[model samples]
Target: MTITPLSDATWLAVAGPGRPASTTIGGWTLVGEVFNRHDPAVRQIPDDDPASYEKKMLARFWGRFIGVRLDGKGRLAALLRDPSGALDCLWWAQGPVTLVASQVPEWLARSAGAGWRINPARVEAALHDPYSTSGDLLIDGPAAVLPGAMVTLNDGIVSELWRPDWLARSAPALSDDEAAERLRDALDQVVAGVLKSGGVLAAEVSGGLDSSIVAATLARTEPDRVRLWLNAWGPDATADERPWVDLLAAHIGITATCQPRATGRLTLEMLTHLTLGIRPGLAAMDALHDADWARRFVAAGIDTVITGKGGDSMFIQPADAGVFVDFHRQRGWRAFLSRANIDLARWNERSVWTLIGAARRPRYTPAAIDDPNPLLRPRIHPEIARHPWLQGIDDLGPAKRRQILGLVQGCGLHGASFQTEVATVFHPLLAQPVTEVCLALPTPQLTLGRRDRALARRAFSDRLPDAITTRRSKGEMTAFYGHLIADGLDVLRPWLLDGRLAAMGLIDRDRGDVALTRESLAWRGGYVDIMTTAAIESWVRAWERRLPGG
Candidate 1:
């Protein structure tokens, strides 16, 4: 652990290995990996005003980092988290003193003793949504400094340093070809920048357009640095992507290692023994595969694991009526009713009249909370915690609003293995430059009024295999997750039905019993929900055991 004093009454504490390296310039301290886009040496903050400093920093630097500036009296003046959310900065008041850290300090919680308690409301909110990126801390005391936002420590005033909607609205209008060219350049630059950092890099090539693009870019940038191209295949045909993986490897002239995903399937023991974080970090059922990969990377002396995680969100992959809505709003009725209408309708396999009606009355609904556990208690008004980006987006078209929401969802992509002890995980697609570029382009342009991520496909068409660039089908893990649930029922039954969540009034015993039965599991098919609930229950139990009496 490293503690750096930011002021007489405040300090920044970073725990665990690979703590971000800090650099001090003009009384402002930058913690984590940061690089100035224009001039690498220009790290000093010229402006004294917080707002001006924020503007300057946003315009100049691009990387995962946090900036903290102090007053002449050695008091913390302002702190800002980078837009990518690659680094975490959480703050909470400990009696009279304010504490800031990269994560929930376990020591502090232990010291608080009885005073520290889990925030049930926050936990319930998380359970209700599961996909929200509101960045609410699970414990009652602390609050996360959300990505692309800042805080005035002295006054406890928080404001936005970066706004996705503003960027979307202000993005310059560009032709399709122009957007593709700019996107290609941004991807190249971001990938190259990561490679320049130097590491025994490994990349997850999932045989999808996104991962393939990332792997291709890595090869194009510094092929020799990448030690492994890892791909996980499932037993079922839907989950088998080895053919695509082989094609990508052959195209890139690098041997790829394909492993069975079931090797790291979630087990009862794995759930109970999970390394707990501030909240439930196990976002996906297959997250254990990450831990397995981490061990392999560590044994092989790998320093970084690159992925194309944010590609779907950044490239606007969802096919929704919002696209047509945005076309009508931006390009006028004439354009929307003509080529745009036909294109969107044909892409979605819907009639022009249906598309017109959808455009006229577009619905931007959040994903429904679909927990199948009968014991799950009902809230008066259960809703996902609203993210900062979701606010002030009422004026935008549904597609743009959904695009921003996609970005919000992308913030939680890191999940459990966000910060591994040995190898760092890097998502080049989530870089600030790439995010901004994607946000700037209109939704129609992003999807080319046809397929998802059309612009991205165009951008990397030359570098990647035609099988990848033009490939429409994506590998599914439904069968893999289904098998996991079916196989683990022996442990999952008693674990969930008798777990902490049930005792805490979150799960209903009778309903849980019915939900876990073969009949119910087959009919409802809530395996994913059950897995999510089990993970959350495990997290709650883990933290409860950390209490003094526990």
Candidate 2:
């Protein structure tokens, strides 16, 4: 860990080799990886106003970073976080001093000593809405510095550094081919930039469109840097993607290491050893899978693992009536009714009349902070705290609003929070530059008012296999997760039924018993709730054991 003093009162502490070294640029101390859009030219903050500084910083640079500047008296003036959330910044006030770090610092825990206890509100919030990006920490006290926001240290005021609405308002009018070319350029630059930094990289070739595109891009950019191509297959045909993987491997002229899905089966012992974060992040079922892959990446001395994680959300992959709404609003009734309506209808597999009605009065709602688990005690569920990005989206068309919400939801993705012990997992698609370009495109252009990720297919068509670019079906892991939950019942049932969560009255014992039965497990949706509950239970146990009196 490197600690750099910004002022007499404030200091910056950064850890991990994946994080770039802190550098002083124009009197501001910046930490984490930052790339200046205007290369070779440095822009200085015009004044001490946090708002103005934030605006200038947003327009000039993009990456996973945090910046801080000092006042004349050698005190911290302002602090800003990157828009992509590629790095985490969490802070809590410790009397006159405000403690800040990427994650909860161990020193604070040691300071609290035996007095530590899990934040019940955060636990309830997580159980209520596991995917929320609210700034609450699982361990009480510390609050997170949300992505694309800034803070005034003296006044303790926080404000947005970047807004989603700005991107929407500035969306350029471009033709299909023009938009595709621009997107292609953005994807290439982001991928190439990461490669230029140099590292022992591995790309996940999941045989899906997104991962395949990433793999193809990596291969074309700097193939020699990518030492491995990793793929995981399942026993069931639905979970297998070996054929597509092989096709991509052949196209890229590289061999891929494919392993059985069962190699990472969830086990009770694994849960106990999980490196606890600010919250219960890893899906209980995916705990072993992530650990297994982490071990492999570490053993191979891989520095980074790139995956197409945010493609679904970023590419607007969901076929919904929102696309029709966006088209109708933007292109006028004549164009929408004549061409877009039919195209969207065909895409959604719905009749034109149904699509029209739904578009006129879209029923799709944002993801609510409510748990579907029958075992959860609803009374303790916390009040819904909407993420900032979801605000002012009511004026947006259904498709665009859902698209923004999808991005917001992606912010809290398990992979975003989960880090391998040593290797850094990078989602190049989620980089700020690529995200801004995609967000600024019209929804119709993004999906062609028909197929999901239509523009993405057009963008990388020349480089990737035709089968992968046009592939509609995705590998299903429903059976894999179902079997995992079924097999782990003996361990999961006792662990959850007699766990800390139940003792705290957060779970209904009677309901949990009914939900964990073989009869309940037969239903496809039942396993998800069970797995979610088990995750929370494991988190509670892990933290309790770490606290003094437990």
Candidate 3:
């Protein structure tokens, strides 16, 4: 489980540490690299002077990489997800990434040999018994370990490994206007950062609550500076998002470029984009035009891009959460209910529901599901119950399920958004602030009974049209690209049918194809995973072609 994070532009590849406890499984070794950017205990060797001088000597024949930035989030560094903690994935994936994994396993693992000791029962027990128990126990190794056993117990790493960045710390207090100002300022910072880096800020205005608000708010700034990008597919390809971007740009009075899906130029680069985006789950399959457009934007003087990625997750109320809360309270009793736990209370009906729903499984950390190890990640929901890797495993439980879902969408984006900006910074609702508010809010406040996603609509009501703000059904960006599937599938079929897909080596492509045919584009089953896989496969081919030996 070697993790090598790549900075192509800087030409740096930082190979991180590995898990001290995990044993080998098949050809791949397991590593544990807990990347808790907020964890206070974790420390790095101070760099009064740096290392990596010798490794680059051999790399000199190829190229050069700058010094590694391990302490901060200044640049995009892939967090290693392997249980063993090594930087070998990059060598296999054929890229440069930091394998910043741990070198020690607090608990003992099953003995080596004996047909992979960690069984489905162990996987289930780990996921179910969420609460940590501290005493140690003798862990029976593989059948071979019937005699000798490794000491095992609830170790801190399990809890520490999955901890979300949200619970870390807090920002200084601010007034309502100040909070709004903070968001706006973050937007400007992203814009300026991009501009300074000779990059353009690609504002992904999905017409949904988050991006729409971001686009509208950004419009109030220097509209000309922000380039609007939309994934044009589904019911209305040419017509989709035309009016919103059109009206917003017109009203804001700036230069807004709408980069839609193009007929030609679909290839493997999208895979690179997916990896860069850190969202290989969906974008890796289709609608690569969005990422292609992003790369184009970068080439066109847009080094920094700003997106409203975590906005919806932040305001989980007024949607499903609101609905959940409404169920418990009658017409009048709603106002009287106070949280059984926390003292802080906010009267905003919308905000309450939004936060609660998004934080349904508060204890379940999204980080666990958002593993960087490709074999263990970019999971598909429909296939989760059926994945070969999941053989003999039981349900992950409701709380854990919620956390896993949140991470797939939330944490996955945390990494994937990088594809847009060579150096991307999510503004307005970064994960830190957003996840806090979301988790604090109770279930009742999150899902407003009648007014689903109301908080978002109300925020942007003045700016967006009723068509988008109040829309119920989400469209398919991939279905719109159905025009190409028939033809593209002709190109995609051979690859899909290839041994790489059939062998379930790169991914469980066989199951993925089955799900792709049945599921919608949004759900991991639907469009998201399909488009992602398509893009990644193509990219892998191209990446291979671009490799030095090739």
| Local distance difference test, candidate 2 | 0.73
Which prediction has more favorable TM-score, 1 or 3? 1
* TM-score versus the correct structure, for each prediction: 0.91, 0.90, 0.49
Q: Between the candidate structures 2 and 3, which one is better when assessed by lDDT?
A: 2
Local distance difference test values of all predictions, in order: 0.75, 0.73, 0.36
List runs of model 2 lying over 4 Å from the truth. Answer: 2-20, 38-50, 105-108, 112-117, 262-265, 283-285, 362-371, 379-382, 414-419, 545-550
Best by lDDT: 1
**lDDT per residue (tens digit) for residues 90-120 in model 3:** 1111134322211111111111112222222
Expressed as tens digits, the lDDT of each residue in 1-550 for candidate 2 is: 6666666777666566434467677767778666766331124434665476567767677766777777887766767778787667776566666666665534546564344567776677767666663345577555666778887777778888677766876787899999998788777877876786667998898899999888888888788898889998988998899999999989988889998764444577855644456556542237667766877888888988888888987888775677777776776666445676887788778889876676566454423323387777875755756667877777777778777776775665533223445666778788777788888887877998778999999899988889888888999987888877777778878888888888888888898888887677785256666776677777787666655565
Candidate 1 vs 2: which has more TM-score: 1
Pairs that clash in candidate 2: none
Query: Judged by TM-score, which candidate is best?
Result: 1
The clash count of every prediction, one per candidate, is 2, 0, 87
